[model samples]
Target: MNVTTILLIFLLGAVLTYVSGNKLASKIALGFSIMAALASFYLLQLYLANQNISFNGVWLQSPKVFLSLQADGISLAMVLLTTCLMPVIVLSSFGNIYNNAKSFYSLVLFMAFAMTGTFLATDGLVYYVFWELALIPIYFIALIWGNGSIESRKKAILKFFIYTLAGSLFMLIAFAYLYTKTGSFLWNDLVKLNLTSTEQTWIFLAFFLAYAIKIPIIPFHTWQAKVYQKAPTVGTMLLSGIMLKMGLYSVIRWQLPLAPLAAKTYMPYVLALSIAGVIYGSIVALKQKDLKKLLAYSSLAHVGLIAAGCYTLTQDGLSGAIAQMIAHGFVIVGLFFAAEVIYRRYDSYKIKDLGGIRSQTPKFSSLFLLLVLASVALPGTYNFVGEFTVLFSLYQINIWYAVFGGTTIILGAYYMLKMFQNVMLGETNTKAFADVNWTETFVFVVIIAFLLLYGLYPKPITDLVTPSVKEILTIINR
Candidate 1:
């Protein structure tokens, strides 16, 4: 009934999952995630009905940073995303034999706890704590359970850890500066500061460095390809599906409103960079022969458009970003799970080593192609709604900008279809590629159902988040 209930569910579930012996750990975690997700949905229903579902308490009295958590329409949307995806992500691991199943599933639940907290925390200091708290479990997850040679895995993990932590330092410094001006770490106080243009510009850049690295926009994305390739499928899912949105969501909630003038001032250059990432990621995806790496670049392309939409600073643009974030979360999890399926059957992830899977595993091929179409933003799929709205918002800004941003559709189709043909539609590989089992089928069914259902009628989600989006816009315009 309260926001704290959701966080408590995940946190307590994490401990209980660890304690539950290896034989039942995965199931326990999966059950916990499903319960939490269902609970979060009910809470979102209450929030939309204008009922208050919040928790506020003092953790520190001197400076008065409260252990406050609350949900308006926007935070619930993100919380729903984190909750919904955790169950699916946990479900995907049911067949695999992890070395330390208890620890692995426990970290998965713990990460969910931190992410939900990040989405719900209204106090700036509490939000930052959850933000940095997320990095801990994922770092170990990748380092301990990830696939690759020790040297390669260590290098990738270290680079990712150092890169992201460095970004957090800048965010912390910006928060410290803002606290001096307002004497409080509440979001309400920060947005109300009458900062001069110089202060706004500097603070904007500070937050920009933090979020951009997390979102992994073009120039800052050096860590993405390597990390994604080296990580296990679950780690990749966490990084791509939910964690990346943390950055995009932060921009809407914190960066833009707190530094409105600078946000407007720097949007042009930022849009150009974001659009550049769209092009860059697509072009690179075309050349990638490794399945995981190809999807990595593809993710980069799609997320670039999401980032560009955020900078468009329009109602259509911001709402479209949220839709795309949720849509992308599901589609990417499906795609990565598909890749894992291919690997398990064929023992290889290289495109050259894969062919004619469709001939043998017709069921998987059918589902995968649908997911591929969704990724390319085909109409009647959820991504199409988000992508079209985003480009339309850019068109309102400038026709040339829209034209450039729109290349993702064509380029995405080219690379996605090309990968599909090369891997799924050749002469049958001289090896077995069995169709997906029941659990895998269940995973794909859940993902596809969400896409099609929302694709047919997106009004519910759009209506739910619009008020919150407008409130952020109102603060920015002030």
Candidate 2:
């Protein structure tokens, strides 16, 4: 089968899961997610076998936007990340009971469907449609299913929705302008346009506004922590684990090659802004008392580094960004799940309220500690490999950039270790914090296994994305 089949699986899954009724919705969703993951692996095999897995066809005549879904190494890697995490994300929700299980699970699958299409779409208009479509599911998921003060949650999610939608308009306008110059909206055609430096700058900034808000680079990141704090744990997982990558991925996939001159011209300034975010997010994370908010800020910091790597426009930088993207996706999910586990038993996320979890639940504390160390980029963990490569790429560009970005390692260690100690160590908590159940253990094991496996032997991932990254870099430097 072709790659479009993967999207069909998720779309069909969303419908079937909803019709299965509440009692069976979660099970059906999990089964479908697993099936999708298997299908993705099959796609991976086809990719390795040098099969043609992409789809391209005419969809509209008025604007000449083709229904193009191209599967390359870079896109396949991202697709794999989305599909594999779908099952883990679905399974992670089994512990909590929601009011409308069917709708919640269905939205989860629908979001996956949209996001998968976003990664695969090769036509500019088609990509934007999937991009916008992805936002809709999360809006309802967080707004309807989220927790906290009703007024505050609504405020946060709405601000996020409006703010991002506004940014996307600029990208739409930029695409419209490009369409005027070139009659086609296909990626190959768009990248071949020889725009002036001035034109490239505006186009770059247009795309930057859209990506930065989604990536939420400093000055634009106000919406993230609040939304993360308010959303349900599973919603939080989906946002931090997968949605954020969309912006970062777009930077590599669309922004750079499409505006190579601007990328080069503004390299220093953007790199500075990204590295600044690294420090900013880390320090903010350091002061956070809420577990989810802390993890949210930590995500902001980590993605800043990933964005920095992308802007470096080097093979190492692009490849490292992808590696880190995958690593952060899994690690962050595990960390958030650990927070949910603690909240499940202790009914709290405040660092002040949690202590001595290790004394009560050894298995959970061990897994939580591993996740914490992974966040801090301790060697032998997947995070360390990704972070180091990103830093190395920064170093090649400017030592100062590397120096500033490297603070994530130190600051990350300080904040994460401190959080772990406050939340998991110290006096035995009086609350009866049960160890993780089989499902929880399964999720943790799956994530940790991937992290450890890839951390030590990263050649598979690096190799998979290298050729695509090289090709993209060629277009950017052409």
Candidate 3:
């Protein structure tokens, strides 16, 4: 797990930020993100050099449990994603947040640490702890600094916290049952214990309930829209861009392989729900006047497709699902940041309140246009590659599913272009508006570059993930 390196870096960042006071907190957080990035790079190099790494002794060994920390290829990929996004997220929020900067930045770093631990933790108990820990900092960040009416923000955060926690309780029970059967909390130990089909069914449902609420397929998504709408832009970015992936990742890492027969038995209903989310989310997004709310619903729709892809149980589907997860993370963050730029300038998120932005803020308009194209899966954008691969894979499962799911692109384009036309190119609404400043320009440029670069050269990511995806498929097929 490289526990020493991971924990040392995380603790050092938290302590330094806490003691440095608020004025320098942002700097400290940025510095820590850079350090984490470098460390992640070094860890990747080490993994490449060694191909295997582990640190295991005994943190706790009791009659019913043994705690261990472990990392594998999938965990490492998630760690890299977390570390890579931290600096960017910090930088994106820099000029945007002013009051109590120290607490804000410190919470950001702590959240990163918790998320990293959640991915790397090998023990079920440790995973659950980190899972809940990751939610705390974001809760306060949103509650304290988020936009919208104070009452609404409070309601949104409370709903998000309660809904996820309720689902998590069921997951905890599932873990307790597994511990009872195996007498260990370690993942490998749990994986080795054989349970009957009925037992696996109940346990898998418990875990699925927790993750589905997080990934938030159709009926479980009532809390997500308000949370994203009320939370601060950066908080929304974190939740939509990264935190949601935790649920999808857990589905792959724990549920399917852990209870293969149950997964297969329930796959049809899961797929149905995912498809419904796709159609329903897109339809609802079309009616949203608020840009953030629109994007939130759009995200739900995209994730639904990814969830369906995951359950397809094909090599292409699994690989595409993983690729789409990363692609969506990047695209959605960039999109939300774009929304923040407009809100900052016009002081409005209402689509009707904006018009003819390209006449004044050419740079901002162009960037927004490019992102919109990417969001709708333009051929040269990263999303197109993911969408194509996902649909192609879904085709193997059922052609009707692919055909229906393909409507998302058409629906996405309808709303995305409509939003673009309304916001960027109509009657000039304001007398004058400024283009993107240096910070805004830099953020958009980086996001666009990755979108284009990965769109053209997806092979690298595909190669890095293929072996792991293949291994997962083997487990499911077993």
Output the TM-score of candidate 3: 0.96
The digit string of per-residue lDDT tens for model 2 on 1-478 reads: 8999999999999999899999999999999999999999998999899998899999999899899999988999999999999999999999999988999999999999999998999899999999999999899999998978789888999999998999999999999999999998899999999999999999999999999999879888999999999999898988999998999999999999999999999999999999999999999998999988999999999999999999999988998899999999999999999999888898888888899889888999899888888888889988889999999999999899999999999999999999988988998777778778999999999999999999999998888899999999989988
Clashing pairs in 1: none
**lDDT of every model, 2 decimals:** 0.91, 0.93, 0.84
Q: What are the per-residue Cα lDDT tens digits for candidate 1 across 1-478?
A: 7998888899999999999979899999999999999899899878877888998888888677988897877788899989999989999998688988899999989998998899988888899999998999898888888888878989998998899999989988999899888888888888999899999999999999989999989799999998888888999999999999999999999999999999999999999999999999999999998999999999999999999999999999999999999999999999999999998888788999999888887899999999999999989989999999999999999888789889999999999999999999978899888779999999999999999989889999999899999999999898
Q: What's the CA error at residue 3 for candidate 1, in Å?
A: 1.0
Rate residue 81 of model 3 by lDDT.
74
Note each model's CA RMSD in angstroms: 0.8, 0.7, 1.6
Q: Alpha-carbon error at 420 in model 3, in Å? A: 0.6
The C-alpha local distance difference test score for the whole of candidate 2 amounts to 0.93
- The estimated TM-scores of all candidates read 0.99, 0.99, 0.96
Task: Give the C-alpha miss distance for residue 435 in model 2, angstroms.
Answer: 1.3
Which segments of candidate 1 are over 4 A away from where they belong?
none
Candidate 2 Cα errors over 4 Å, as ranges: none
Q: How does residue 178 of candidate 1 score in lDDT?
A: 90
* lDDT for position 344 in model 3: 82
